[model samples]
Target: MSIRKNVLFACLTIIGLLPLSFANAAPDDVFIFSGTRLPTALSEVGSSVSTITAEQIKQKGYRTALDVVEEFAGVTVNQNGGFGGVGSVRIRGALSEQTLVLIDGVPVNDPSSPGGGFDFARIDTSNIAKIEVLKGNQSTLWGSDAIGGVVSITTKIATSPKAIKAYVEAGSFSTYKGGSEISLSNDLGSFRGAFSGMTTNGISKAESGDGNAERDGFDSKTFSGNGLIYLPASAKITAAILYNDSMLEYDGWGAQTGVSDADVTSETEELSGHITLSLPLFKGRLENTFLTGYSETERNYFTSGSKTYDYFGDRLLFRYQGTLNANETNRIAFGAEHEKTTSGRDENSIDSLFILYEIKPMKNATISAAVRVDDHSVFGSETTSRFSAVYRPHNDWKIHGSWAEGFKAPTIFQLSYYFPYSSKVSGNQDLNPETSKSFDVGVERAFLKSRGIIGVTYFRQNTKNQIDYIDGWYENVNKVKSKGIEVAGEYRLSDALGFEVDYSYIDAKKGDGNRQLSVPKNSGSARLIFAPSKVLSAAITMRHNGLEKNTYGNVKSWNRLDINGSYKLSSKLELYGTIENIFDEEYQQVYGYGTPGTSANVGLRLSM
Candidate 1:
């Protein structure tokens, strides 16, 4: 037998022998750090929430956060080519940019955009500790862009006194990556930091021999680092920086249809930092945090003039939580946020304040609400709100429901950018913020006495006054609606074998008859994992994207398979490998874009 096959069999044998021991272990405690009014237990969240842990990321061999998120129902990613292209993610048919992203309880979405949507592709998962996704409108607590849902990424915070880890790998497409991390922690103080870089030249296509747009390739580079410090009195501080440069030198749909281009480049630089403090208060806990950051993005389409913009923002929050007591459970938080943008012909700003409150009426029931108001440079003022409820009837089952609203202020470019698009156009300074209302209801069931979890959710959203460019002019569309059903589950088949599945069906429509670009009707993912021994693990994943019909009368669909494995050479050394698009599917989720094909990479990791 081949060495690889022999290893797989050996691991399976070990797992098969530990079934009883695996089931007899102590029950685990689940925590939900990004849902509800505060960092609460998973059982306390009043709405549907999902978590992807660091171990899961490694076990699944996911190269990007977007890839891992696919396993969750109602989630889909719009990716292009090998490097940087406009990439986004959608949840329940909602636009990609509409979902809010947070880092350590602070918003990271670029307020400079009309939708305040940030591209998910710009983030690397190397430094991420965990991700918590809260599906449904979160506008009440997070304000704008939370109309669709929320994705919160929390970086690693070291607890050990000292540690160091490093890895290097080479993969398909002539891609190479390497990184190192160091962390120091003690009773008096704690500090952690990480640095990573990656590069890629080109990719091998499934259908070769032609200069097809899909054959166009790319080159990419990225550097990122983050640091955290903690004080003795429960005070913490953090700083982080990220930089990415990508060049595309190929043709896709844009090339096939006469808009042929050979060079497209995207560059981005961002730096962010924050400080937080928590203290005991009058019969409750008082906490505060302040965050600030800056980011710049420039994209050159070869034909389109290079567009550049810079953004700056800050946020401050304060909260008070009373201890849990019979018939008395309450927690409240308030915060203020502001952002400013600067660029040629594009200058804008916003200021807002928001608050959230959670109350427990009974032992098994809880209610929560949030509200926010924002003043925009152009749109003037807007308000958002939400309310939710949670009920637990059995130790293994819970039900949650919520209703929320959100608003998005127009961007400087969306309002003013003008080109010789058959005519001269002017900015619409009177454009109003896009308004959205959404709701969700779901049930979470844990089987095998809590060894497995299954969840189903139904969600709907209606957005009005959507901004669009029409014949060199900007206009507001009347209405847009998105509704969907999602089913997801995670099961531990054995101590060393596990599986997760997610499926979603979305029905999205525009009141004006224009189709929403890059939104798919059906999407799903399945993952199977095997941990043969403490030192060896492997995963197989499958992804499905349903056919989408564009407004221009074009249809497309895609499916891809991936495999990942890792082995521990010793207590401080490890080896890992990932093979993406194992079947080499050739397809596009976007109308005119190149997608990565089959690729593979192997690397070694060391820790001390």
Candidate 2:
């Protein structure tokens, strides 16, 4: 039998056997705010979504957002080197740029970036409360650049009267990490802030197979702050900011035209902030929110300490939203948003209006419809819509389905390329915004008595006007198709012991029937956890990264195992440890970039 067919059969047989091997009840206490822009039960959302809570982050030793989302289905992460290296994420076969990333619901994608995508490498998790991931097209509610869905991060804002938390860690390659968080809450308002930094004498990015000796290193610092002032009549004012500065040394292509140097360096700074006012009126039936924010990103690349190139991107956002709780079962929401992207090249602005209605026809069913129209200064107009429904036959089984449209505007470089060299690529001024239509259906079963839960989802997305190089210039000539299946389950044998597994299979291709680059066809991840007592908790996680075609060659599948644990020694002190790549899996997520081997770290946290 062929390898692809064999792999498919093995995956099905394994997932098909999970329910019989273990038992558990609904693990749906997770509250999601991104799916509907309001706090809603996990089981009620019609999309395939995942959440990583603060507790889970600690238990799994998740140091970055990338670590937290690796286990999610239909997600693939690629790194250029070791810790703090450039990272890219592809969701459900969509292009990396298609995924919309938000910090506190504020878009952070760099407009100057090659394709205007968020760089996962720059994210820091100093005071994150949760990471919410939504799959499939979400352009209807979120507007453009959300075709692949959204990854929204919420930082910790709630505080005690007085609290301070600190942590430190040290390990291989002269690596060091530390962070501190402080919070104050009073009758009038609340304030919280966090600071973190990390530095490492890292590994070689370009491996010669004989063990390259050139070492690449990185240093970074991050800060987060949130403040709120409670006003009279159930109103509040809030301010928030996030910042990061980092420097990294990496290898550039060797002698090849597209390759970089061996000792290339990069320095970057990014800042995003927001101020908001919220009010509740009409006897708590009507609510309103107003927000404005700005984001700036700048990067400089150099060789031999001499700056070779630089780029800067900035964005501004203003939004107003209102919600009406019409009755016990009917809810309505509407919003208007304006966003502008500015690079040195051009300033483009877009105005968007959106509305969503949710209906609970009965106790066991919820139906929602959303529509959005975006008017761009350059591209004229585009409209998108979504319809979703969820039905619960009983407390244990939920069936859900959704149909949605997607849209993405052409990038600045793609539309304004004007290099003088004959060899330089040119752009098209008349390129249309890319668009897509997608649908998904899924079934989930939850058991009672805290036994366990299982879910399977099937999805398909067809995209048109996918920008590609045709006849030596960028054009919308590709029609791409992507389909996938996701199977996830969590089982608990006892109150203190449990296991989880998530699997994804994707068949993605471009118009000419070529496999998508950097997209894995089959991948799976599993985790086992034990919490024998209130003071002790640990988990072992295993992940499989499937095959893909890359510049380095047809990369093979690889697996890794990581173990993390925590022990509470006292009310004010705790110890934690993590061992990564336990079996020394020497594989690469991005070809040519060296992957880390087995490494261990120890840390301590003091909290009050």
Q: Which candidate is the best by lDDT?
A: 2
| Per-model C-alpha RMSD | 9.9, 10.7
User: Model 2, poorest ten-residue lDDT window?
Assistant: 19-28
TM-score of each candidate? 0.85, 0.93
Model 2 ranges off by over 4 Å: 1-32, 208-211, 255-261, 418-425, 469-473
How would you encode candidate 1's per-residue C-alpha lDDT over 61-115 as one tens digit per residue?
A: 7667776566777877776544545567777777777788876565666544444
Show where candidate 1 strays beyond 4 Å. 1-32, 111-115, 204-210, 213-233, 243-261, 277-280, 298-328, 422-424, 513-515, 551-555
The TM-score, computed over Cα atoms with residue i paired to residue i, of candidate 1 is 0.85
Report the poorest 10 consecutive residues by lDDT, candidate 1.
19-28
CA-RMSD of model 1: 9.9
- Cα misplacement distance, residue 290 of candidate 2 (Å): 0.3
- Sum up the clashes in candidate 1: 2
lDDT of 2: 0.83
Error of 1 at 588 (Å): 1.6
What's the lDDT for residue 17 in model 1? Answer: 29
Cα lDDT tens digits, model 2, 568-602, are 99999999999999998888787767777889889
